[model samples]
Target: MTTIEELLPDDLLETLRGRAAGYDEDNRFFTEDLEDLKAARYLTMLVPEEFGGHGLTLRQASQAQRRLAQAAPATALGINMHHVIMGMAYTLWRRGDHRLDWVFEDAVKGEIFAFGISEAGNDAVLFDSVSTATPSGDGGYTISGTKIFTSLSPVWTRLVVHARHEDQLVFGFLDRDADGIEIINDWDTLGMRASQSCTTKLHEVVMRPERVGTHTPLGPNPDPLVWGIFGAFELLLAAVYTGIGERAVNLAVEIVGKRRSHVKNAPYAHDPDIRWQIASAGILMDGVVLQLEKLTGDVDLVGTGEEPQYGGKWFLHFSGVKGRATEAAKEAVELAVRTTGGSQYFRRSELQRLYRDVVAGLYHPSDNESLHASYAKALLGPVRE
Candidate 1:
């Protein structure tokens, strides 16, 4: 029973942890991590068995992702975009939809995939796109616009982007070497620096029509693509933060058990208040982990045609999970810092980096405001627009 937890060997995980600090310090992409993951065939974890992949279910992948995050938060976060995209394709394929089979094909062929649909000021999310994709008069379209937060920008071989084409929102794939695609090296950020989530600029980039996977009217509809993206992204994002929280709890416990006091102490682990704080953080994290297990497990139900009974309810659930997990990560990190004393405040400390990285979970989609609104809608019916 080689479970997802064993996907990354202890030695590999240690190397990742050792390099994490240097990568963050230099604001560099996790190139070595990516290479190791590729060698392990992790990039194709979700691809079908016929495609020479592990064919792990979404649940297993989510578990593996959490474990990966424990070793390198930024690396896991960056790789998550790719995994979520693959998860989306898998979800569709499992339900007899072959529209995205090409994505899986590409994945099995060692081509890196990056999700580039997010845009600045287009909070409408999957419903709208600020970028434009006009007919190129050759059964293709010319996409022109800028996409921000394009993770894996420095290494991805292919990028998937969405843009408005007339009254429809269309999503297509672009090659990294595409003639008019430019990756702006402007991803210097306060946290998750190793992600290299740079801005991507499209200048009349031509994409073949076959590459256009989904096209829908510019608004909500009974489209599984939308649901898959929302589901996979939120769930996996939650998993990453949950991993960060787990690490924080472990670190807190280790520090409290090791730090000694000259006055009257064997170690602070025996101190009532220190134990209380660590216990509290552990309890919070326990709730998050249980929620993750449930959500990821139910994702299979979504792929098995049981989605209609739940309908839009899963979105609300996922929002709650993402919000709760991120906040719990922050809380756990804060408690870890407090228990570890002032030594964690220094830049060289791993706790210092975890503190910075955990806060970034706040910026992802289904943010606090949106999460509240969605929860309200789910509980109290739709509010007046």
Candidate 2:
């Protein structure tokens, strides 16, 4: 079996790491990194072998993402949106639904897919949409709405989007050159700047009948499409943050080994307080690894003809792991910065860059507020009216 290390070799990672600072500093899209990844066929990792891809499972793909993130987080994150779309299609196909087979086919042909689901005020996410999808008199739909945080916008050939169609929610793909679609290049942010996840506005864009994927009832249910999206999205997202934590811990260890304490006349690694902080960061990272392994392994078991039971706790499982991973990653990064002292505060320091990038975790879906509310509802049932 080909490993992630072989695919994303040390040389490639080093090259990416070398350019990370420049991308972040200039707030530019990771154009060079994207080209490198494309040459390596990283985008089609989840597509099956028969489709001319590596045919890696979600577990393997998540591991690959973690390694890529350790090199350049923004690069990994920008590409992650494409993998998430591929993973969702793979999830559906694994369960004998071939409606999304075209995703794999297009991916093999090098068509990049961008996620266009987020809206300004729509917190319902995946369950409801503020965008409207009106019938276009020929079984297709004319979608009109704005989608925010559209990663891979600079290069995506196809965009997967969803909109409200009366009582049902419609999912479809829009070509980049399609009429009435506009990509706003306003991706300036505090961190993850290289992702270039800008805002996309749809002015009654037409989605052909063949491009329409799935339709589900409003307000969440047991739709396989929903499960596919949540499953691939949450786990893959957690992997990126986990990689950030791992990088922070590794950097801290390296710094401690080389820097000596003036007060103690010895390396900071010998100091009990520094050691404790590093150890705490490692422990938090370990918990995230354990959670990722269990969840991703269980998800991959479907390929072996064995379905792991979640007992109606699937949402909690997915969202909860994401919440834990992101929080743990943020805390771990903090501890690392503390151990490294004042040097990490400088803009030139990689640790400082990691610090800024990790802050974006608090903003992703399954946020603290939603996670807490979901946990409460899961444990005690929905609240009284």
Candidate 3:
């Protein structure tokens, strides 16, 4: 029952916000913020109570992410990768699958888990991988491939990766210092700079059999693992972007209320056009947050032993939510920037940073194009693949 409000005390949240600009300016990882989060037990929020965590449900965790994001989007997002993987393991364990219990236990004990599944041009999503997972005959796998956008690159203790093994798509965690593991710190980017989501190269990195978690075939299937990952990742990601939108709207409101219009001798908030624009952003943000609450709340209810009512529809909903929320967040940020005028374009402005950060959402899975294609398939029946 530990809310984000409790975990991130007001003073800590202020300190984090105060440092966000410095981290973004240096294009460095939010090392100080990460340590603060760890100390606050934010990293272990989703782990089970028996494992020394707050045992927050996914719904609660999603809210926590949103609140954290409102303070520091990049920090919240970078750490969200860890939460997504841990949420998956804990969820599976709660649903009577104990295979990934070790992952949850370690996470609760303060182990940092980083996501390492994305690859260049491998848009098969989770169904396929460009990396290879060659069996080492001792039941282990010798993984050899590069993973791009590997978040938490500098400090991950365990990396959850997905790669191909003949016809099967293998997935599991590996020690950060495992042989052949290399981290390339070339994370210069437009937004989420503090995330330090860099490139991870694996040159025949070896993983023990115990480390390999799941092996599903290379295509769409009715695997709960797939559902769990997609659900947690998409929903939590949406929440983070939504937080950005929320913050942007609030900032715009504050700035507009203080800026005087030269002709009218009144605040910009008095202008009908300015009020309408900020209102539109607020409305869009409201819709995104409502959608997140609806979907995550449903998932929480389903976790109580009932059949998954959403089924495949869950993924569709997630895709829609993620795509829409991201777009909405981007729109909100853009509006905030416009409302603030030329002053926000500077590197020192938080709105400028947020505007860039929101763009990163467009690159995540369920991009606008992909979401449209899926919607077409869902609504009008599938075209020839």
TM-scores across all candidates?
0.96, 0.98, 0.97
Candidate 1 pairs with clashing backbones: none
TM-score of 2: 0.98
User: Ten residues in a row with the worst lDDT in model 1?
Assistant: 302-311
Q: What are the runs in model 1 whose C-alpha is more than 4 Å off?
A: 303-308, 381-385
What is the C-alpha local distance difference test score of each model? 0.87, 0.92, 0.88
> What local lDDT does model 3 show for residue 201?
95
Please report how far candidate 2 places residue 261 from its true position, in Å. 0.9
Task: Summarize candidate 1's per-residue lDDT along 1-385 as a digit string, tens digits.
Answer: 3457456888988999999999999999999999999988888888888766788888888888889998999999999999988988887887788898888888888888888988999887777999998998877898999999999988899888889988998877888888898889998899999999999999999888788777888865657777788788999999999999999999989987889976775798988899999999999999999998888888876546464466667777878899999999999999999999898999999999999999899999878988887678668988677
Best by lDDT: 2
Instruction: Point out the higher-scoring one by TM-score: 2 or 3.
Output: 2
Q: Rank by TM-score, descending?
A: 2, 3, 1
> Between the candidate structures 1 and 2, which one is better when assessed by lDDT?
2
Residue-by-residue lDDT tens digits, candidate 2, 204-257: 999999999889999757787778888888999999999999999999999999
> Candidate 3, after superposition: displacement of residue 31 in Å?
0.8
Clashing pairs in 2: none
